[model samples]
Target: MTESNDGIDRRSAAPMYDQLRRLIVEHIENDRLQPGDPLPGEHRLCDQYGVSRTVVRQALGQLEHEGLIERVKGKGTFVARPRTAESLVHTLVGLYEEVERRGGHVHSDILRHERITADAEVARALELDEGAPVVVLERLRHVDGDAWSLSTTWMPEDVGTHSFDVDLREASLYRLLAEQGIVATHGVRSAEATVATHEQAQLLGLTAGAALLRLRSVSRDESGRPIEFFVAYHRGDRSRFEFQLDADSSRGELIRIP
Candidate 1:
């Protein structure tokens, strides 16, 4: 025990509560205290630091707010276990695969899957003329058994045909597509913050006028062939996006490609 910490004489110049909070946190950071370790009781803290009960409580409040400690209902205040990295949302790893990795239950329900003529937007994205044959697949995704997002895919006819197999209901569609020879090697993605339409909101079991994430992307195969055009409506409350940035030494990065 240090002489100064044991008898911390409060000066009129410095605030006592904030100083106490920093002193306690520094002890934790230096491995003097660890998670699951108990903190001194409120009365004991007030006595040790020579501070008022109010000052001790206020300092503890800040520590709890910062997630450095927790006050259990019956048990006394204890250090908190730090949180680990969690995925915000879908990336190239496949939506189903990514969610499970984050400790969330995953499910996909095929709402509609059909072969139809391409609409104007689909035609343009797929690089096909209007009325070209296209396979459209609609799916509702659930995370932890709650409705989370909706995905719609438009597969150009040049891509392998789409079908409604049992795997589509309960497995990764990307893996299924890979087995069928339409491997999605890479994609060009665009994301924007948007409000859900009335129809979309209803399907997602959300309020009629709600905010959502509108994600769209075009995936291609090894030969640089545009095969799949996908639009996903992700719930803002239940979804987020993550980006991994690494140094790219190769200056050959394609600029203005979007």
Candidate 2:
């Protein structure tokens, strides 16, 4: 393997292991490493990157957690084969953006997009008075031509209806919101496993009573004002979610969802 001193930058604000992990991903992306190909052993990586074994382990652990690489018993880590399912970290980007970033062909079929009076949940989520105007967006997310998820988003009508005029099937909602000077800086996310309803299954191309993963989120701006409320139902057979927790953060507790 070719070694370059440019791989790690001591002056960078990013952690050393993160940089190393990116370097490895770059190698895979650049065709230097093919799927199922063995990655350099920990000692070799340590020597090549001029980092300690702990750093190497951290990097490897992250790569494995992301499904980019895998470790077999008594065998070194290797590049993982391409996956048919979709996954994303708990980030602010929309589902379409995430799927496209992972090299999947993604598009949305807009089911409902109109101004409506806020229901109790929508009003509470957006901190608006009951029956206030809100823009409701219902969509079926297609990944690789499969209807993978059903999502509904609600935003204050004044903020969403007046500004959102683009073709949502061809645009990202978050991007459109940003162009209008509204950006979500943080969000609260929670997920649960539930069986698909008959209507949901019909929309998602799954059978009724099939397992589903439901994600609910409330996004807010820097001023702590709620910007959007989103709920998504994902096909359990075709989707997953991954989260990275800081080992140093006291609030970083890992919750396993069945």
Candidate 3:
């Protein structure tokens, strides 16, 4: 709504959609709109806010992205249910175990999990000579039905990928590796906050400039031979990770993975 010749804010000068989003979110915060309360109809909202239907609709979309609102097909937008803390543990567990234990469901969409010749980066990370063949595994991990993360793991080809032919939706890669006499006895992992790259954003279903958690690790056997090097990018909003100074043990000497 705008006022002429008076000391009133001009709705046209400022984006009406942003203004409407602010107004609606404020209502929810101040108790004017409760969780189950129905939002006004699209046409009605336009009339009430003195804006076009386009502006009103776009505003609703913004609220939905912020996780403050949800829209049903036949119904309308409603407040999103509050999210609880998923365990923020920093453990060297299999991706499968970690997701399940954190109260999240896990599934994988196989991208590629096969033996391949290692590049300089992969060979160095896996502690193998450059250009050596390696077992490289790539998969997209889903948690709570959303694509929570994407991972690529590299291992020396001498270890063989045959035993790690992971069932995309069922088996665990780490578990498979252990069963094949390569128990990741202990290893090191590094994590950092980062912005998703163009390629990473596409694979993770994130906006081109979204924030992400890049977790890289190198798991090894008792002999300290680097067996697997992994890199995973997790959605910043829907995922969390934790780090501990040391986890109640000092049997293995700690070293940097990256």
* Index of the highest-TM-score prediction: 3
Query: In model 2, which runs have C-alpha deviations exceeding 4 angstroms?
Result: 1-89, 162-164, 250-258
- lDDT score, residue 11, model 3? 44
Q: Which candidate gets the maximum lDDT versus the true structure?
A: 2
| Winner of 2 and 3 under TM-score | 3
Whole-model lDDT per candidate: 0.73, 0.81, 0.71
What would the per-residue lDDT of candidate 1 be over residues 145-229, giving only the tens digit for each residue? 7677889989876453646544677787777777788787776776677887878877786655555777788888888888888
RMSD of every prediction: 9.4, 13.6, 6.7
Span of 10 residues, lowest total lDDT, candidate 1:
249-258
TM-scores for every candidate against the unseen true structure: 0.61, 0.64, 0.67
Tell me how far the alpha carbon of residue 102 in candidate 1 is from the true structure, in angstroms, after superposition: 3.0
The regions of model 1 sitting more than 4 angstroms off are 1-90, 158-162, 249-258
How does model 3 fare in lDDT? 0.71
Clashes of each: 0, 0, 0
Clashing pairs in 1: none
What global local distance difference test value does model 2 have? 0.81
Question: What does candidate 3's lDDT look like per residue over 1-258, in tens digits?
Answer: 232222214646767788788877776777666655776667767767667889878998788667677555457766755443433335668768776776767888878767788888888887888889897778888776767788887888767555454465766777777777887777677677888788877777665766677888878889999988888887765654544456666455555543
